[model samples]
Target chain A: MNREKVILLVEDNPDDEALTLRALAKNRITNEVVVAHDGLEALDYLFGAGEHEGRDTSVLPQVTLLDLKLPKIDGLEVLRRIRADDRTRLLPVVILTSSKEEQDLVAGYSLGVNSYVRKPVDFVEFTEAVRQLGLYWLILNENPGRV
Target chain B: MMDRLFSLRVRVLVLVLLAVVPAMLLMLLSARDRRDASEESGRARALQLARSVEVDYMHRIDTTRSFLAPLAQVFALVPNLSNVTQTACASFFDKLIANTADIFQVGVASTDGTVICRSPAGAESAASVAAEPFFTTAMNSRAFSVGHFEFESVTQKPALHVGYPIIGPAGTVTGVLYAALDLNAISTDLGKTADPSVSFITLITPTGTILARYPNPEQWVGKEVGTPPSLAAMESGGPGITRESVSLDGISVVSATVGLANAGASEPGAGSISALVSVGIPKDQVFAGINDRLRDDLLGLLAAALLAGGLGWFGSGVLLRKLQLYVGTTRRFSEGDLAARAGPPYPRNELGALGRSIDDMAVAVSERQQEIQRLNEGLEQRVADRTAQLEAANKELESFSYSVSHDLRAPLRSIDGFSQALVEDYADVLDDEGKQMLGRVRAGSQRMGQLIDDILQLSRVSRAEVGKEEVDLSVMASGIVDDLRRTEPHREVEFQAAPGLTVTGDRRLLRIALENLIGNAWKFTSHTERPQIEFGAEGGPGKPVYFVRDNGAGFDMAYAGKLFGAFQRLHAMDEFPGTGVGLATVQRVIHRHGGRVWAEGATGQGATFSFTLGGSS
Candidate 1:
């Protein structure tokens, strides 16, 4: 159960990725954190393409942390694609962005993002955000059954 | 020259008066001369009558003397003087009297002034004249003598006595012979004139006694003559006419008078003839002679004057009608009706030319005004276009600011996150200075993030859709102050918020603005020992100026000018730790609602933030 409890983080910025990983690690969230540097890469991993071509497409993560600013498919578009697909329609996705712009948050939520969170500029606040997210999604939140 | 300024009718009248007045005066003068000439002709006629009377009298006296001489011859040659008896003389005298109309009696008297044989004999005829002066003078002088005027006893008529003495063979006067000459026949002879056209012809004595008068010879033959008022000029036996003279019957007349003595009278009667012949014409009759021509000429002149006046009036009426129309046009044009035209149907003379000029000027002015109006209208469009361009530019700027704000936060977040991670992850290797430096970097990046957020908030409120509603500011202020207390729970701050404070505005924006105000008050009063904050709407109902007041360290009024400016701070950063954008955001939000915000406070004293919403309470 713990092995299957995985978290995916789609982020383009290396610093944000490193900081997010550090925060997750410092919070002792031992769930597997699958890191994708771009929205396309993350989509590829989620749909079992490219390097993860042979991976079981049905083995989905418990939660997806989507970053809005990306190199290839933006976060909102990825969420739209994910929601359009029957397999990932019920999956929980949280939007994470350095910009706390209201339009982005609203768009993310309208596109079926389960939650929206801003990347705090402070390490302590980021850690606490990560810890609470981990505790709720990895431990308490019930996940969809594998199709 | 002066007539030119007057209207045509007046000018016509004036010109006619000027031309006709002198001519009328000349006619009057000529008429007076004609009257005087008529009067002179009348005087000449009277002089002629006087001359005729004088010649007749002188001839009659000579004839009488000749007859007496013949008689003296006849009587002296008679051989028997005693044989010339009264019967013979009487028959001879009767024969002589029958031959002459003027001879009333012809008789021979004795040298002793005895009675003479008289024709148509009356009793005592010789005795009646026996003591007469003329008989005595004839007997004594023994020459022909004409006696004074007398009344014949038998005829009882005025007459004159002419006597001739009989001469003896010795050439001494023997007896006196005399004849009585009737003067009444003079008036009868005067009545035989060819025409009695003049008013009267009178023969007057020098004593103002009339001996004969014409046209009624028998009535005034022996009366006193009619006298003129100023007879001094004509009384000298001179021939003259007196204007405004009165006649014998007291009628006003133009009279001519002549002394009969001026006519050819011989020595016997030269100084003794005091008779005058007066021919007088009444002025009424004199004027009546030329009245028809005068009346006709005057009527012609009057008719001409009326014709001129009527022509002037009629012609001027036509001209003035057009002028009045032109006047109306001018008045309308002056009153700003540029479309007014002076003429459509008026005559095309000077007035019409003026009308056309006025219309042309009006057209030119109207065209110019239309051009100006078009320009003004174009100016409005240009202004609207310019405003639209400015609005587009402002829109571009707002979107740019929004995007800038959105993008700027990412780098600040990265910087702050990394700095904080370095301090936390590398805690064992970092010294106090390194850690503090990293902490400073974290704080600066975080502070920058906060400024970006605040700036974005201010910009958002600027462009935000104002969804107006009745927002209970009292509730909003209470909630904001409660949140502030919860945020700084350890602080001993007192808060008071009045209830039922209402206003109309966007609740979201108002909440943000009030939060800023309350937060500012809370932050500024942190140093006050007994800090009290009051959040309530002030002023009268329907218009409340909501204020968040706190007993805190206030700022000097000198810095009030910069109080609402972004990033402007009165206290040092360490003393009042904040992004310093709260009040700016508040001001922007309040301003977006068409309200304004201001603060007043002293150092270490309370500060108050007051704001007013637009239109609605």
Candidate 2:
């Protein structure tokens, strides 16, 4: 059931997005990764509106890797909306970004992100970080969706 | 010079005396003038009294002479006195003596000193008239003569004898007619006309004999009046002379004496009888009233002056006390006690008005002080508002840095990550130089990331709030050294951090500062044969200069000014690889703790980084 659960990747920059996907592939995280380019697109996908209309909204991600900087509706606002909605209130969210700013970490935690990781510049370190995240959330940890 | 001594009381006393003294002097002057006028009037009164007494004496003598003149003419007409004519004269003389109270005796005497006829028959007659001065004077001078003053044997009263010479048919003196006038009777008559202020009236002979004295004729009539200042004046024979002297009766008197005119002098040589009339008024009696008034006026004036001086002295003291209170209150207010006031319970006079004015000024000054204080507070509020605006701008800058940290690093990571991926995955397609170029790109991107991280850290140190706690610098340095050792366990570096080195500052910031300093010491000393790093402090507590020393590739003293600048490195990247921001971060952290940081070194010798956490250390 955890293997069938989805991963949400909310990112804005294409380079960072491509690097992140490549890192996930290198780590062998076989779970389906749903890509949302901006904060607004991620929210739309979660609630099954806009381009994701007619999609089932009850299906929640196993883990959401959210970047703080985005084009539309910013990441903290999307997090606020996700936590405010009862459907995605308990969903495990991870903050994955290049920034190690204190405000960003504090705001991410305060907004109910379960895990926080700085995306390392070295591809090897990035691949290792993604492997740990995938093994912990998908294999070792029990899914709240099964409950 | 004596201004302090001349207090209000003294000034008031001086003013009082200034007002009183002139009045006192004027009063004294007027009193003196009054005394002079009183003395002049007294002398005039005494002179007048003496003149009046003299007139009475002369009238008596003139009356006697006139009565004798007719009888002499009668005798001159007959050569000898017949019994019929003598008997008729005797009867007439008796009648005259009985009628006249002034004449005590009347007689006719021959030149041979035989009594021819007597008016009073039973009276004892002197055997010879030849011894009598009046008879001799009248016979020799052929004129009427007045005798010296004497006391008669029978009456024991003073008298003056007057004689007229009788001329015969052959023009030789034959007989004399003489009369003795009672001086007491004359004095009694004069007393009736005398002034009541006159203490004594005296008839004095030219020889200084008291012929008669009024009020006590019997005691003084035959006594010689000693030549006192008054008697000497009388003997000078002036018409009238006044003297202030002690009289025969031992009374202080202002006496005037005048010589009486000899009314019976028929020739120049016949004017031998010189007499005087003197009147004395007691000196005290003359000026007693004026003296009494002057004394009373002086006493009253003295009392008034005393009262005025006393009022000025003590009254001014009262005013001075209040004035001092006002002065003290004003001084205190000026000296910054804005609440100081000349408090309540004011006097009801001009002094009170002055006090109220002072209090009003104090209140006004206090209000002005309050106004100034309020203005200062308002200025402070404006400063606080400006500071808040600056903080907002700073917060915006921090957020912008945060965005840069996030956005700039993402592309950097991609560049490095992709270049790494290309080196690993596309190894066959890439030539060695191409692969080397990608490796350079990877190194450049990684270095950029490191620079960005170090810049963010320095900015974080700038923005961070410094928190205070006990930070053991030696322990912190040892811990950092331990971490460095663990990273490169094979390096046999000698670390010497002073034991128990401590300070009071922001713990995290101090730790970070020590980490940077000690870390630099460790890194710079890595190439040395036997690397040694020493962390210690000098100076006193709370003012210690902490030092991190390293036997390493030290910097030149010439470039010391640029040592702590961000991105400033003394050595090349290949020699001692660093981001060149460690010392800058250390400087920032030390500065945030209100401290100073400095570096000392000689190239290739060693380096020492020293810092002081200001006074808070």
Candidate 3:
């Protein structure tokens, strides 16, 4: 239980966060989920800065699931900061957002994100998307340092 | 195009020269007449000179014959005279010669060629003179005769010999009375009136032998001249005339020849007695008068050219100045100064009237331009006011459409999600009525959202800029039909699209317009047994009209005018499924392309929707 993979989720909306959590729980992914309310918290958790300061710098998250729209900093900027830092440059990142705007998906991937997944309006489709993401990123995807 | 280098003055000069050159050429033709006139004058002058000198030539023979004729009579009476009688006649001859020095000597010779008597005793040999042609001529004649010219032994000068026969009482010739007249005396007389620079006088025989000549007569007195035709003409007793030839000095000249009149002789042809007088002058001097005439002609031509050129130059300058003013006025008018006009009318003539016409035209143009300017200002103000009003309305419409798209979507999504949640989670507690109510809410919300989207697209079509391209409406109609068939594969439908129906318009907007049209056909044709939809372009009044005709449920003609309204529907929702904004979108698209759309239908007949891509057509 202590050796569980750390997963960072960046989202600002309460309903979207609840829905995503519900979807993840339904997909049977009981990982060490660190929910960041905004892009700033997400960046801090990944790079060990801001409120996540003094945390073990070597204890990196296995995957980051980012949302594009946020209160202060956007999810694309968080991904950009993570990619820019050498310690977190190779870390796996997946963009999850409610926006179907093509520009958001393009921007997220342009910042070195590993995946771009739209959070579907339909909960059933949303659950299925989360299941695939958890299966691929937590189990199938391999990272040499973390493994 | 006229080169700028040839100004008005230069062009006028050229115009003057155009006349001058031909005039000069014509004057040159007349100058030939002048040459001919000078030559005629030369001939006449030469003839006059020859006639004047020829009188002297005739008098020489006449004087000698006058005294000698009576003397011959006296000698004939004493045909057998002694030496005393001959000496007495010689003293009479000397007395006759004392009165006239032109008579050199007089003698009488016998038929035996012996000197019978001398006028001044011992003046000749008293031997037979039969060898002398004069003596032989006298012997042959019964009364009188003349002989050819020869050098007399006594005087050693060239002289003409005249002889008369002394007949005896038996009417037989006994001796000859002879006279030697000086030929140099005739030359001296001709030289009195002769101008050497103009001409020289000559006495020549019929055989072209020169007997005497004036002006250096010592050098050319007895030489044959080169002008034989003159000598021949004179010898033939031709009238006084001139001919071209060379003189004895080998210089080119025209020689005039006249037969000298014999003196007191009954016949001029007797013994071919009369001498021929001729005059010759150089050709250059004869034609020299023409050079003065040509020089005067040159001066006159120059004066004429200057007069015409100066007049033309001044006139052209005046005309060009007026033209320049006209140009300046035109330029100012073109530059948008509507008040500018060419002024100051000219008098009544072609060029003057042209200047007046320019001013009149400029005034008209200025008035028209001022009117146009006023109209343009009014139009521009109207356009500005209309544009601002349009911009305001557009801004309001944009925000309304944006709010419809952005703000309304979230509520719609929430309504749909909540309704779905109610159906799923409260299925046990909710009765059929309750579930139906929630479903109606969800359905109505989704329909409203679809309406919003269609309305937004309509607004977008109005705002968008048109990009024109060659669009095959046939191909596009076929595609929409295929999509419709794919969406409802069980709905058996027959669709006909005219092949190669092409036009230039925005492809995307035209496709949207076509979709709405064909989609309406599809929806409206649902109740028909065999739904047939046909799309085609047909020749219309001013442009090709495209129509979508369907064998489907159609509206009453009374409501046709309201057919393209946003919510206006021809069919009940239970019968035909549509948001009722489809035709509105089609109208918007057609209007965006600056085209028109209309519908024609009856209650039961199929409907036909027609449109023209050509604006106002």
Compare the candidates by TM-score and give the number of the best one: 2
Best-to-worst ranking by lDDT: 2, 3, 1
**lDDT for each residue of candidate 1 in A67-123, tens digit (9 for 90 to 100):** 887887888899999999888898889888876767788888899888888877776
Worst 10 residues of 2 chain A by lDDT: A138-147
lDDT of candidate 2 at residue B606, scale 0 to 100: 84
Model 2, span B1-617: residue lDDT tens = 12553476787888888888898888888988988888888989999988877777778888999989988887777676433244555566788889887898888887786776766655565677788888888988899988767776666778888999988878988789888898888878767877677888888777778887876776777787664344455444456788887877899988888877555555322244367787888989988977898889889988988999988877877777788888888888889888888887789988788888888998888888889999999999999999999999899989889887988888888889889889888999999999999988988888888898889889889888888888788888999999999998998899898899878788878888888888888888888889999998888674778899999888899999998999998898988888989889999998988889999999888899999886364
Question: Each prediction's Cα lDDT score?
Answer: 0.75, 0.83, 0.76
Q: What is the interface RMSD of each candidate, in Å?
A: 2.0, 1.0, 4.0
Q: Candidate 3 lDDT, tens digit per residue, A61-96?
A: 778888776768977788888889888888888988
By lDDT, the best candidate is 2
**After superposition on all CA atoms, how large is the RMSD of candidate 2?**
4.8
The CAPRI category of model 3 is incorrect
The per-model DockQ list reads 0.44, 0.63, 0.06
Please give the ranking of all candidate structures by TM-score, highest first, separated by commas: 2, 1, 3
* Docking quality level of the chain pair in candidate 1: acceptable
Clashing pairs in 1: B208-B225, B503-B617, B551-B606, B552-B605, B552-B606, B553-B604, B554-B602
Please give, for residues B277-393, the per-residue lDDT of candidate 1 as tens digits.
676767677666656656776788778877877777777777766677777888898998888887576466887778788888888899999999999999999999999998998
Stretches of candidate 2 above 4 Å error?
Answer: A1-6, A39-62, A71-92, A110-112, A131-147, B1-14, B77-88, B97-101, B204-210, B216-229, B232-241, B246-251, B259-276, B292-381, B615-617
Clashing pairs in 2: B542-B617
